[model samples]
Target: MDMVSPHTKNTTELRDRKRTGEILMGHGYKRGAAKLIGVLVALVGFGLVHGRPVDATDKVRIALSVRNVVFLPFYYAKDRKIYHKHGLDVEIIQMRSDLQLAGVVSGEIDYTPAIGPATLGAANSMPVKAVAVLYNAPLFSLVTPASVSSLEDLEGKRVAVSRIGSDSHRFGSLMLENGGADSKKVTFIQTGSTTVSLASLQQGAVAAAVLSPPFTGIMAEKGFKVLGRSRSLVESPWLGLVTSKQKLERQPEEVKNMLLSMRDVITAIQRDKADVISYIEKNFKVSKANATESYDEIAGVIVDAMFMRDDQIKKYLEGTHARGETSKLLAPEDLFDFSLVRGLK
Candidate 1:
């Protein structure tokens, strides 16, 4: 992909903002917040009449669990204009894991690169389907203060997670269970996000926390010790792309384009480690060492293709059941639609 000069990119963004403002002003919206509202309105497919031809590129809104390295493929796709190259105007939205499914089901968000456990639960209740596995292994670590050397030491102490029933919660519980500590003996605190969970740990409000890359590296750099990693406890599909079945049926070409863009992103990141590292450092606001550490920790897990094995999905479901989150056994077909990217290389 050809790179756009920083000046050119900034100019383009300013022009787009100006256009949005003009459209909103014509629609009787004041200038101050019109640009923001105009962007939102355009994202939801509302036509704005500016006496100019409508944009031919399809707009897609995708949700992320948080702004972390685990979703780097989507980030790289947007940053490098891979999505645009594939004829998509992708808007990335970050939100809590629990709310992402609702956005997809309500048609407010077009795709979600959500956690496997939560995605399975959403699939069981709705027409949403997992179309791609971005990371086949859990990207979280059971981190504890330096004084608390082992998982056993966390007994009767508070542990923090992004939220209950989130990937962090499941990973923390599994880490405790694998260490022979009854998770019931530990108090799980919901910290809203990994950044906050780390803050809770720093404040000594929680003895330990389950954190993913970048934040995990940040905590470790602050003198915390990693008691365990989630990948060691479970081998399931960790993160994947999800969309409604209606989307697959109604916009097959667009879905294919999105997947193709994702493929390009994976390829780009894999082939250009320095660029990805720079992106990580700039976006996460971490040092070069921290950024490289985060990328190294997660690079091995990102897959080039979108498909997840049947056994992998089954193992994820089984793990979720073992954690007592859900009792129903869902087959691979019940949770995912592998057919979407079947022919994509």
Candidate 2:
């Protein structure tokens, strides 16, 4: 046999490497050092003409204030693989609203679905901006012991809220104001969460508590009086998705994918009432009856598009100012970016 030339020998070696890589891949070895080496061999053999290497899927971290039904859409999106369908790997973290702001601004967290007070932090020049409204009306209700018949009865009594500057407190104050009761006369004790607020109410530490569903439903089931709901008192954007403006500008596609996922979630909420209730029952750890009650309270107000109208943002800003949370009144354009939602169907 004739001796093979050096060039032919090199070509034969590359072909052998390519065949080995294909065999390894065919044997279901698509990970670890073997996969890396296979990819390298293929790259060197094919040269740059084979096109660029495949990029890893993007991962997004989202924070939520609490595990409540208000964020049903997000829960649904995760459980139903909607985020995966959008080509994103989403991680949901339960964090306090105060902490979430810092997370978003520092780029530690990519997105947050926050309440009014938390979202208002954007007005203070925080890097985050509210991109979409999740809940148009408040989800909280002033629940009291059976002895108290109405909001008027709780004038001199102590009420429990999540915190002083929290959404629960805002809803409680708004309810008191709408009920024509003096909010100042009613002391708001901070219980840290709706569950703790309920505990406080049950233990007689508080006469009433600003509890959102399914806690509110539990209270009602236990004979607590539903004194009033925040929906009647407040119509501002109670909850919404917030992200850094930098992310909005630099990662427009990711932001758009997130909003698209949300849009689908909202549509699911509207079209499939039973599925939403089931999700609420599973995620919130509540009874089906409680889930249904919670669903009924928010179904009509769940927004398909995250767009906040001029009046809605103005009302939110006014409410924020009224609570003394922020003195500066920012316009809708200043606090929100409606461009992302505009493209969503």
lDDT of 1 at 306: 62
Q: Give the Cα-based TM-score of candidate 1 against the true structure.
A: 0.81
Residue 97, model 2, lDDT: 69
lDDT of 2 by residue, 1-345 (tens): 001111111011212435534533543433222122234333334541121111244357777665566667777888889988888788776656666665565444578777464445655555557888878887788888888867888888899888887777877888988888899899988877666776788999999888777778888899989888888766777667887766787778888888888888788788889988887777677889999988888786777667867887788787677667786777777778888798775
Off by over 4 Å in 1: 1-58
lDDT of 1: 0.69
Candidates in order have lDDT scores of: 0.69, 0.70
Cα-based lDDT at residue 200, candidate 2: 80
Q: Local error of candidate 1 at 211, Å?
A: 1.0
Give the clashing pairs for model 2.
Answer: none
Give the Cα error of residue 204 in candidate 1, in Å: 1.4
Q: For residues 1-345, what per-residue lDDT tens digits would candidate 1 score against the true structure?
A: 001111122111322445645644554544432223224334334322121111464357776655566667887788899998988888775544565665565454578777564455443555667888777788778888899867888889999887776677877888888887889899999876665776788999899988877777888888999888887766667677787666777777777888888878878888999999999888767889998988887677876676767776777777666656665766677677888688785
> TM-score of each candidate?
0.81, 0.81
